[model samples]
Target: MNAIQLKQMTSAKGFIAALDQSGGSTPKALKQYGVNEDAWTTEEEMFQLVHQMRTRVIKAPAFKGDRIIASILFENTMNRKIDDKYTADYLWEEKQVVPILKIDKGLADLENGVQVMKPMPELDDLLKQAQKRHIFGTKMRSVIKEANEEGIKKIVDQQFEIAKRIIAYDLVPIIEPEVDIHAPEKTKCEELLKKYIKEDLKALGKDQKVMFKLTIPNIDNFYADLMGDTHVVRVVALSGGYSQDEACEKLTHNHGMIASFSRALLQDLSSSQSDADFNKMLKDSIEKIYQASIK
Candidate 1:
C-alpha cells in the first residue's frame, strides 16, 4: 500500500471521479459525450473510442488531485496508457490522484430484489496486475432494489469477503452496495443496508480498513456512524442517476460523505466542444463537486 495515498484517501478534501464505466455502460457514456453508436463497430474499436474520451477527461486541466483525489478505472482503462504512462501511473505521477480499479465482472441477475456481483474467478490475477501497475485500491458494486434483508445481507457479505482478499494483497476495497434511488422502499433499503454493513465492519480484522460507495441517503447524514467507524477510510456517495445539481445539493446535507460521480461529472462535456469550451465546462463542474464534497 502507498502510505501517502492512504493518508489522502482518509483526509483529502476532494471527491472521487468514477470513470470506471465498463462493457455495458461504455456505449451510453460515449453517447452522452456526443459520440454516436455508428462511431465504432468492433468492440476493440469501441473501447478505443471510449479510451480516447477518458484520455481527454484525464488530461483536462481541471482533473488534478486538487479536486479529484482519486479516480476509479475499468479493467480496460487500467491496462491502457495516458501520455505514454500506464493509466494508473499517469494518475498518481502526473496528477497526484490515487488510481483505483473496478474489479467486479458486473452485477448478477436480480434475485431476492437485489443483484449481487458476478463471480470474479480471475480476481487474484487481476489484483496481481493491479499491484504491478501501482493501483492503490479497488471498487466493486452490487445493487439493492428493495428492502430485502436477506438480499442486502448477501450483498454486504460478498463485498466484505472479497474485500478481505483484496486487503490480503494490501489494496483497499471500496464496497459499493447501491440502493436504488427510485425504489419505493428506498429509506427502508438504506436502513437495512446500514445494518448489514455495520455487522460486516465488526468482523473485519483490527488492522484492516475499507471504503464505501453508496447512494445518497433519503435522510441526511444517515451513514454518519459508518463514516466515523475506525475500520472505515472514507464514505463516498454515488450520483445514482441524479443530475449534477441534484447530487451536489444532496451532498451538502450529508456532512462526511464525498462524491464519486460519473454521469453527473460528464453530463456537460461533449466531443463537439472546443478545447477551451471543454476545459471551462470541466473546471466549473469540478469546482461545484469540490465544494459539495468539502462541506
Candidate 2:
C-alpha cells in the first residue's frame, strides 16, 4: 500500500468519487450523461463513449485531489488510459487523486431480503493487476432490501470474507453493503447492518484494516463509531438514488462520514456540454460535496 495515499484517505477533507458504474449500470449512466442506447451499436463503442466522459471529468480543473481525495473505478476503466497514461497512473500523477477498483461482478438475485455479490473467480488475478497499475484499494458491493437479520448477516459476512482476501494482497477493501433507500424498513435495515458490521470488525486480526461505503443512514451520525474503529480506515456514504442536492444536504448532519457519490456527482454533467460549461458544472458540484463532507 502507498503510505501517502493511505494518509490522504484517512485524513483528507474531501469526498470520494464513485465513477464505477459497470456493465449492469452503464446504460443508465450514459443515458443520464445525454447518450442513449441508440448512440452505440457495439459494446466496445459503448465503453469508448463512457471512457471519454471519464477522461473529460478527470482532466477537468476542478477534479483536484484536495476536494476529491480518491476515485473508485470500474475494472474496465482501470484497464483503460487517460491522456495516453494508464488511468490509475494519470489519477495519481496528474490529478493527485488516489485510484480504487470496483471488483464485484454484480449482485446476485435477492434472497432472504438481501442480494449478495456474485462470485468473483477472477479476484486474485484482478488484485495482482491492480497492484501493478498503482491502485490504492478496491470496492465491492451487495444490497439489503429489508431488515432481515439472517440476510443482512450473510451479506456482511461475505463482504468481510472477501475483504480479508483483498487485504492478503496488501490492498484495502471498501466493504459496501448498501441498504436500499426505498426499503420500508430502512432504519431497521441500518440497525441490522451496523450490528453485523461491528461483529465482523471484531473478528479482524490486530493489524488488519479496511474501509466502508454505505448508504446515508436514516439517523444522523449513526455510523460515527464505526469511523473510529481501529479496523476501519474510513467510512464513506453512497448516494444510492438521492439527487445531488438531497445527498449533499444529508451528508452535513453525518459527522465523520464522507461522500462517495455516483449519480449525484454526475447529475449535472452531459456529453453535449462545451468544455467550459462542463468544467464549471463539475466544479460547482465538487464544491458542494466537499463542503458537506467537511461538515
Candidate 3:
C-alpha cells in the first residue's frame, strides 16, 4: 500500500476512530472492564493495563473503509508491539484503517475555559518519529462550554497556532474545538465556531489544509460554512458526553461530518471479554458507526 497524506485520509472515504484516549479516560474505561484502579497508585503503574486494553480494543475485525472507518488516531504511547508487531503496523497490515498519531500533551486551563496541548516542547521530534513510522495525521483538542467570545477566540487562535506548525512538519492537523453538548448556547456557540474557524483558516497559506473534529451541533448541517470551505478537507464529529445511540442519531443528521469519537466508540467494549467477544463488540460498534457515517 502507498503512504496516505492528510488530505487523502479525509478526501478518500470513511470516518476516523478517535482511540487516542491519551490515558485521560483510561481509569474509567478500565473500571468498566472490571480492573481495580485502587491498587495502581500511579498512572505509570497502569501502563501495562492500558496497553493491554489498547491491544484488545484495536483488534477491530478487518474491513474496508468504504462504509466504515477511514483511519485511527492512536495514543502517543501505543507505538509498542502488539502480537510481536507495532500496533500501528498491525492496523495498517490488516488494511483496516489508516494509522495516525496523537501528538498533543493534553489540556490546560485558560482564564475562561480549556485549551489543549500544553507545553508541547517535544512535538516536533514526535512528528518526525510518526513520519518515520508512517503515521498519517494527528489530533489535538480544545474545549468550550458556553459563549465566551474571548475564550472561543483563544481556542481557535491556539488551534491554528499549532496547526501551522504541524503543516510545516507535513502532517494534517485534526483541529478539535469541542463545545459542551449541554451548554446553553449550543446552537449559538456553533455559529460562533464557524465564524472563528473560517476567519482563522482564511489567514493561512493557500496550500494549507485542516480537518475539523467538532461537537455535533443542535441542528443538522449547522457547519455548512466549514464543510464548504476549500481549506477544510473534512469535518469529523466528537461524541462529547452523548451516548452511542444519541451520538449516532446526531451524527447522521450532519451532512458532511463523520464520527471521530473516543468514548462512544469504546463504550460497549470491555477488557474482560474473550478475544471472540471483544472482536464481536468491535464489529458491532464499527457497524453502528459505519451506518451513521454514511448517513
RMSD of each: 0.6, 0.6, 2.4
TM of each candidate vs. truth:
0.99, 0.99, 0.90
Ten contiguous residues minimizing lDDT sum, candidate 3? 1-10
lDDT of 1 by residue, 1-295 (tens): 9999999999989999999999999999999999999999899999999999999999999999999999999999999999899999999999999999999999999999999999999999999999999999999999999888899999999999999999999999999999999989999999999998999999999999999999999999999999889999999999999999999999999998999999999999999999999999999999999999999
Q: Candidate 1 — which residues are off by over 4 angstroms? A: none
How displaced is residue 248 in candidate 1, in Å? Answer: 0.5
- Please, what are the lDDT tens digits per residue for candidate 3 over residues 220-256? 8888678877778788988898999999998998876
State how far residue 143 of model 2 sits from its true place (Å). 0.3
Candidate 1 contains a number of clashing pairs equal to 0
User: lDDT at 283 for candidate 3?
Assistant: 79
Q: Model 1 misses residue 74 by how many Å? A: 0.5
lDDT of 2: 0.95
Query: How much does candidate 1 score in TM-score?
Result: 0.99
Report how far residue 88 has shifted in candidate 2, in Å.
Answer: 0.3
Q: What is candidate 2's CA lDDT for residue 119?
A: 97
TM-score of 2: 0.99
